[model samples]
Target: MTIRLAILASGRGSNLQAILDAIAAGTLDARVVGVFSDRPDAQALQRVPEALRWSRTPKSFANRAAFDAALADAVAASAPDWVVCVGYMRILGAAFVQRFHGRVLNIHPSLLPKYKGLHTHQRALEAGDAWHGASVHFVVPELDAGAVIAQARIAVEPTDDADALAARVLTVEHPLLLHVLGLATAGRLAESAGHALVDGQRLYTPLPLPLNPT
Candidate 1:
């Protein structure tokens, strides 16, 4: 069965493009029901039809909680089996998370357990890490501390700068999210007690993607 997706993005929507491309190429069995953004001018909204697009500035609402309540209602209206946050900039509140608890997913540009928030590439370079990459995981309340489903790794070269490292990671990240979502739509992936399960078994470690060309 094809799964319906509700995407939340706040930027260029490069990852959203990957999903769209995959579905168009007949590689993914999913349909994008809607695209939601917190920023009125977000480029991501342009990728979907006008009817499937929704945006509301936080300033229009009294507070963050109020904004989230409206956002949750909009997302629930689509009845999405999965909610994928691509470049969504807002931090989701507890009310929104609990509403669709086990169904939210996010892809972060780091090895995770290292850099949970922004500037991951620079942080890794400064720390002299040998490897750096992106991780696709379940989105829980505690930032990116949820169970990782899979990751795409890239070696950090001695000559690499933050920009260079980030560019390299982006190449693999697209495929990484697609891979994880493929399993999800196929009924081979799930979340239980904040843990990731694949093929009905616990995923002790995130499945790693082999290195691709940078």
Candidate 2:
């Protein structure tokens, strides 16, 4: 069965591009039915056909809840089997998370439980952490505090700044999201009893990021 995928992004759709590339390369058996964003000028919108692209300004809504409600409606219209958030800046409300539950996934720039929110690279540098990476996880209501499925680790260089670190992490993020999504499309990855499951087995720890050459 072909997996119907929907994407929500707020900036340049690097991850979105990765998924598209994977689908085109016949590495992922899925179709991106819809691409939605809060910003009309988000570069991610250009990755898909105009008909599949959707944009709405959050300021037009009275509150975050209202915006998310409308966004949920837009996503539901596509009847996506899974919703992936890549560079999506907004935090989803409880109602939206509950509506999709385990089906919604997100990729974060830092190893989760370390930096849950933005400025991940700067935070890691400030903390003087030795390693930094990205995480692919199930999206829950509490920020990035969801069950992680996989992570890609990269060593922090002494000369690395936020942008430099981000660029390195992004290299792994592309392959990581593609790898996890492939598992999801094949029904090999799922959430069970608040824990992530792979091939019907519980995942106590996130799987390591697959090695991809720069």
Cα lDDT tens digits for candidate 1, 140-174: 87888889999999889888999999889999999
List, residue by residue over 1-214, the lDDT tens digit for candidate 2: 7899999999999999999999999989999999999999999999999999999999999999999999999999999999999999999899998898889999999999899998999999999998999999999889998899999989898999999999999999998999899899889988866789999999989999664433
What lDDT is reached at residue 144 by model 1? 88
User: TM-score of every model?
Assistant: 0.97, 0.97
Please list the residue runs of candidate 1 whose C-alpha ends up more than 4 Å from where it truly belongs after superposition: none
Leading candidate by TM-score = 1
lDDT of 1: 0.93
